[model samples]
Target: MSDGKTIILNRIREALRENPAPRPHASHTSSDQEETPRDHTPREWLPKVGERLDEQIDLFARQSEGLKTEFHRCGTMEDARAILSVLVAEGAWKKIATHTTPDTSALLEKNRAEILKTDTGYQIDDLESCDAGITGCECLVAQTGAILVSAPSAGGRALSVLPPHHIIIARTSQMVPDLTAALELAKERYGNKFPSFLSFITGPSRTGDIERILVLGAHGPKRLTVLLLED
Candidate 1:
């Protein structure tokens, strides 16, 4: 093999050694004489999560709560708008940043005076000072309580990660049982080509780096809120 390929392989092996994966099976059984040899890697790696959409959504909410993420379920976009309006009014968030995606952009339209919408008279630097940010998500991975975000769906990676308070506006149809299912959906959506960045966000940014004491918003948003649009 080429030197570059060998080096890459070595790094991968080292990473595997540092954090070993669970053994799929204790031992392999001897194959029957008439049986054909087959690889089960895909099956082993992508085991069935065995959850319906509602079950997955429940699990997602529970896990997100464990991470201090707040959830608001809305039957319609108007309900979602009311929730956001209340949040801003009560929390005293003077300025807000959101992506240009149609869903979020439409929501922002009602409260244009407070929005920091980039390129529509708003700019990137304004987001740093904005009290909160909002964007649409690609999918909600229930198994891990993660919101799958990509550049195309979310508008900009920076808009998702840079704000102190991050809000996700997503529909119930985006729900999936697990990471594997979410990835498969993304594959179908993007085909061979994909966005520059896709992020799996579980909750607010946190760390236990300073003497193991819990810290919120250590590197990113201090709070995360999800507005799930119910059918």
Candidate 2:
């Protein structure tokens, strides 16, 4: 064998002879000890979030700013309605798509734009034509500034993605401190009957692939506005 190949083989043999390094959070299955499941939780590696609600909201706001998401904290439903109205006026939206939810129905009751409810069903072309999509969310993750939306919470998958602008109307009570907490909440809330679709939307769709120039709405909504109402 060549000197280089022999040296490589000798190194491999030496490595095999030495004891392997223990895997992080791995469970040992020796004869004397009982075998336990490996720990998969990554709480230690995640960013720390405050226990207080205000601190969490603040973190979420800061993260959202970095992600270029428009976030508004409304003290009342009326405030949210006013914000929605302003958005409609600014965008000159002639039509909006949404699902049937108490909050959505209340906010869009007197909207100037035509409403397309996707509760039962909707066409892709019609949904795509709408200027904006309005929907409720499952929860807001403060640590990552992510909004969790499921098919049941928001409208069908297309409603949020097809429109040019995506607006989320959620209550402050739905906010969670981190992704782990959000997952736990989902498990506790849904149990075995979880929604068919679950997604984490960090911000408006964007890409910096072409010449390292950031562009929004590359694959999804160009604008993401969160209207957070106090419960």
lDDT of 2 at 74: 94
Candidate 2 stretches with Cα past 4 Å from truth are 1-40
C-alpha TM-scores of all predictions: 0.78, 0.83
Task: Point out the worst 10-residue segment of candidate 1 by lDDT.
Answer: 34-43
Native RMSD of candidate 1 (Å): 5.8
lDDT of model 2 at residue 105?
93
Task: Tell me the deviation in Å of residue 37 in model 1.
Answer: 13
Per-structure clash totals for the candidates: 0, 0
**Taking the tens digit of each residue's C-alpha lDDT, what string does model 1 give over 116-224?**
7653445557878888889888899887788999987776777777879899998889998888778899899999899889999989999999899989998799999
List, residue by residue over 1-231, the lDDT tens digit for candidate 2.
579989999999999897987755534445644443433256755899999999999999999999999999999888988999999998899999999999999889789899898999998888989999999999999999999999999987889889999999999899999999989988998999998889999999999999999999898999999999898
lDDT per model, in order?
0.80, 0.91
lDDT for model 2 comes to: 0.91
